[model samples]
Target: MILICKPGSPVDSAKKEIRLVEIEPSSEFDAEICSRFCFVSLDHDPLPRYTALSYAWETALTTEQIKVNGAALAVTPNLGRALRYLRKSDTTVAYWIDAVSINQDDGEEKLQQIRLMANIYRCAQTVCIWLGEPSESSPLGMSLIGGRAIEGEPHELLCGQALTTEYAVECAQALKEILSRPWWSRLWAAQEFALGSASVFMCGRQWFDSTQLIKDGTLNMIVSILSIRGVPAESLMLLKYVGSISLTQTTAIKRLWDLMPSQKPSGRAEIFCEILDQCTTKLCSDDRDRVFGLLGLSPESLALSIDATYDNSMTEVFESLTINLLRHLDSLLVLFTAGVGHPGDVEYRSGVRVRLEDPYLPSWVRDLRRPRLEWMFPPWYGKYRTPFNAFASKEWTYRYANNQLMLKGLRIGNIPAVGLGTVCQSHFYRPGEQADGRRVLQSWMALCDVAGRERGRDPYPHGGFKADAFCRTLYGDFKTTIIMSGRGDFNSVRLQASDVDAIVQSADWAEKLAQYSDEEGEQEAFSIPPFIIGRRLFVTDTGYFGNGGAWIEPNDQIFIIMGCHYSVILRPTNSLQSCTTYRLVEICYVHGIMDGELFDGVPFTGKSEDESTEAYLERTEQLGDHVIEPVCLC
Candidate 1:
């Protein structure tokens, strides 16, 4: 007979009371896992010490039963295994596990507890990262992470000395299994780990200190070892496996580890937008949690007066957050993440037919429910530099009303032609795919050539060969490089003459590789950054070449909004003659005018050389062709 778990008593919000579970001790591994809840006030003289559990909720369907306060409680298999492994035989231990500590059915209590999540983890004596049940190789993986060899044998893998090819491949395979676990992809895991004062990794019967891995440089050392020359064929395969996981998965964890409250630079609060962007690839069952789950890490959450509640709809929550970000941040940077457009909208090679407005949100709001593209211009922080000052030091001036975003900016001309859109990375790298990445790239080159000839400008009007401009525009004029520690870093650097020549040569090399080779390794030699996965190439009516969103089409106007780092594509919603409103297509990268060049010179019309600068400026605002005025975005 299955016994249902009874609801616990309500938490006292006034006193900041929270629930903690005391896992009953058991001598046998198969003994029934029993736990009881106890309420404690965070206001106590000394905070109650417990180990907080950080894990991924792999699924909500409970598959196992555990005894909680003399009643049976349904829990996920992973959580049950975690509890069984953590329960001590000698004495009862207290744990603050999210699944048990808070009543899941009670939204009010969840919200209240969530607001205190940061403190809950911070006050804990330790945070145990449950990476799930162990495999045959799990013990070896744990040992290697702790700077030991297989079966406790001595090895130099982590000591910066060389290891045998056989051991290197074995160790790489073991590490791959551990890093490929689902917990690393979780959004909450990052938050829990960052907020915790101390953290430990536990996998079934084996565990290790997280700091030891960092101090010993195990991950870096392994990467370097695997990259060594003259390795065996099997080791090379393992090298690729380890390298892919390290770049895509483990780097995120390491980055968050660096930003933990204990390790981050002094006096620097985490930027909310940057955090949101970083967590875009993270997994969460509830889309709303994308914002709520990250609030604890961002002080801007409190500054914007955001409340943690499930009462609001997903659209409402996302829209509210976007508006708050724009208003409080005093910049239009929030819009950079918006305008992905609804999935149902059709994108064709010749043109696009967008839905104009999302059913649940204005075009200006970023719907966190959908996948997002990489920012065309990253924020001016850390290793990234924003090369474009499109508005030339002007501050953002705008307001929102009736779900419309009004902004002041000068309209650069519309797109007269658009090239083929880019395809998914799988199609580019994977053999036997329908779309050829080379064909797509060559088609873009063909379009540029045709457009330039049609306009009677063989060389680009920007005074450079069309090929050079196309190559530079494809990369957004930035050089991306991997640092010594395996972290990817990109900076906005002006492409030097040599860099441009090398890019052209690489393009030619890629064309030859595509024709002769089907091997993924050979194809990867000529690759573009993942950022350009869904972007398209386009040429403006006013002689500018750019990279834009896949949904861009002819007649879509580009705008250099004040205080924005990059140019934006805005599709007019009304008649072209008197269009006052537009649907935001997406942000784009225009080649020539990124450095405030559009506003470069003014020939004062019918004015004497003696005219004062102030009078000339006043006259230009009234009579100039490029006037900055309010454009409404719906």
Candidate 2:
């Protein structure tokens, strides 16, 4: 008998009927064997505790068939292998495998199964993870891991003492063999692993302690083993795929995340952010799974009714995530880490680099569908990247309606001048004459000279005067770094006046460059060519000069947009109804004005004596209402 759950119609619920397949155990695999099945109503009968199968859906191996109630049921080669291993000669096992248990043709049933996925796994006595047929090294690997499972204290082998050369070599092979499985990278696998109460990893006919392998010190042991010398190059190559599942999935395993094992517990927002950041590289068939997969693990996921619905479009799902994130979190800090590079082919610094030309997405929103660009570094030689958290709470407000993002912000000034772009070929040079600090100092001086000449307000008429003012404009603080000289408030630079050195004699500059070299590495010629080429020196209307992106044009508007952590550049378009519209040009990296520390109360009296930002705003108001409005990005 083969019990088939009828296709879910409009009037029927997912829980109305149940399909059951009674799998007969056999000694070995038989291609043409038939099995019996029955249908039971969940409302009338008490369901039996069964094992749930968790495995990756391999597309190439999907044509294989297995017998069910005298009929051929198509399945993946991996599933067929799993079924063969689970079968016995005399006994029949009651198992809940999603592929056979759920009606795949019915969209309603599929959605319902996804909703009940957490409970289904939790109800199972054991979760069997099929990692396909084992390799030649599988037995050795299992034995090595199994050996560590001593009386009550299994991981003592790993934590006891430093591994010997012999042990390291052996563990290296074992680790390479174990991590090479495809199960670790799947998004659904992550959720399945977390929801299961007890797990059993099945490979061929052999079984191992799945709990110990994932939660225990197996990864650490493998890392240690690989670190030892004399490991083969091929073995080392295999270790590259050995990545851990997200912390969220691990949290779901315990059914509680009040306190992470190694991490200090924070609020739900913090946890969600961490999970999203860490698991950006995890693979999923559907783009929506990128957001939906983590909902089961996140404690605050209930706030947004983001259920597993197949009806929602990709854009709609993305919109839902963005809107909900904004509602839950006060700041739009995530936008700062969004996908960005040069306009055409935005390359990543690490991982698999693929160019994305998504004109549909707004510049403010991150393309969650793309591969994680979290590894991409900013264009600075030795700059330490820190999260933007400058403003106090309630400083910014945002709303998303009619597919438009609205925000309250302030206008800073227009970009008047920029620096030379990286026109030369990308270089792969050492920390020699190419990375000379004197050259950078010269470029700064040149920018200051050009801007001063254009403005007709030359602050530095002499040699050292130019260098000193340029330094002050960049790194000088208000109260301390800038001192009131006889002429005006002059920012000071501690430059070394060496008698032998000619071009910008300063050991301090070299020392600064050296600090960056240590953090980022010496060979960075290929990394920041865009930053190098487009290193435009931007001079604001108020005479504030600093280095901005090459994309920053002469007329580009630099704004301190509220809710955004970094300063954004926008190009003014056609005027509409007394308001000037703007298009997103590019996000810039202006050295001094990034945190708005210099934008606040800093005096700019170069144009007029004692005229502050307040005075400029007052004058503008007297002229006419110049409303700084946000353009609705489609």
Candidate 3:
């Protein structure tokens, strides 16, 4: 038998492509065969391991009384340097090669078989593609990747563990040969760009040892493999990724849709489509809980495929679903954290917030989102992505309180960020700052200032009083400052003593505490020291003070004062594994003594509690405000 690609499509004749020829299948293929194929590795130490697995496979096959349906065909290039061994049935195993093209015999049948080449590769006992030589990054990473049970296997010899570096190079060079031939060119009849595009694309990037790198590369490669035309569906059968992360069901379905030619799809494509369709069906099951198991998310009623059949018009459907998928993923992340442990792992922390001006967009279309985003934020911070750290904290009792940074980006790629973007940006408040001057609330106010100063926007909730502070002071009253954070273009809200105390006292604390930081000694603008719960509240021009991003009545705030905050360190469990200490600033509302009333009190009161201006950590643990409830973003 000879394999050939259909040549009606355009191609350069001189290039060589992978080809194979086979002798007829034998009824007596049951004859005990010798090694038909073998592993090759440069690692001298690994020789023993490959020798072992080869034997293990042979024994395993023999134990099952496996019989080849036909003469064992070795489909490979002429490179024997990589061939370790191939002896099946005492040399009865037939072979084919590109180095020695098949003789012109029964050409049509061969061409047909070649079209289904992907399927052939998939069904193989194993393709054993070269993984390239291992380098400095591999040994430890490989050890972790390979389970404890398989550690002893001579993977060095069988899997080219030491040759990973060179493997990709060799593959590119070899693939160049396979794709360049007159026969292989026949397969390029219609989808010509795919071959060169895929070849160059694959050669450009290689996987690193980290689990994240391995995972990212695998996903990209799998998508690449499916997108290319004429690639065998079987190419995925042995498609093993180093990491244990499995493809989400939607991903698997998408890959199948992209790679397999459904119209006249061969056995492999047909079967794969069936499997994926079943997966889709399972995702859309009537049983609500059952759907998540199949889709890694809840699936919509139907999926529109992205393929040759799709039109530019179909982009709407794709965009819509993709956004929904992202939203679903974000929701799931929250769901996973909920009820986990007294919000121990649930603190939102500070992270970037990426909101797209136009959620519905196509890549080819120019950025049409500039108008809306610009109006919301200044030029430097508008039209595109802006990152902001949503400051959140865990209870001191919980171990995760140090603070976490989350990075978010949008409209940047076809694959939407899972939380939109994959980057994380986290900064933390120091422990010493938790004093009674409403330190936490001060931190919150500071953020508002920063947001307004840097981005020309306030960190206040939209339509809230704090937003009004944007017009009053670039950096709002110092209880908190929203400053430029590591999260892209977003600001981070850091709490100060006054803000912390007020947050605890007021439920809609975002509003009621507007004038609470007032102090008779307060001046218009002054930076608060990091560790001061300073309580010399100054009387501010509340008569002229602007309200949260909105106009304030001159009578709304008569006096503005500062209050001291209490600090506490708490956690969920005693385990040392996770104990994030939090310094909470408690804010108190204070009233000044009437001018003459101070000395003319009805009866000389004994020294009142909290009268002294010293750090007053209470002797008793305050249970009411000790732990805070996790703020939900949904």
**Ranking, TM-score, top scorer first:** 1, 2, 3
Per-residue lDDT tens digits for candidate 2, residues 1-634, read: 2244332322124454445566787776677545555554344436565677888777584477666656667777777777777784367766777777776777777776666566667667788887778787787665554444454433455445665666657766775576556776677777677767788777777777655564434454445445654566565545634534432234333444333233332244444555565556567888888767766555444433565676887667766776676665554645543433334455675884444556665555655655433221132211213333222122345556566565544466676645332222231233454554335533554556632433222444222344444443443321332211211123232323331132224434433423322323333231222223434445566444544444455677766565565666666656573335455554554444456453344332221456643333223211111233444433
Best first by lDDT, ranked: 1, 2, 3
TM-score of each: 0.74, 0.67, 0.23
lDDT of each: 0.64, 0.52, 0.24
lDDT of 3 by residue, 514-618 (tens): 223222223222222211221211112211111111111111211111110111111122223222211111111111111111122233222246543111111
Better of 1 and 3 by TM-score: 1
Evaluated at residue 117, the lDDT of candidate 3 is 30
- lDDT of residue 155 for candidate 3: 28
User: What 10-residue stretch in candidate 3 is worst by lDDT?
Assistant: 50-59
lDDT winner between 2 and 3, please give it. Answer: 2
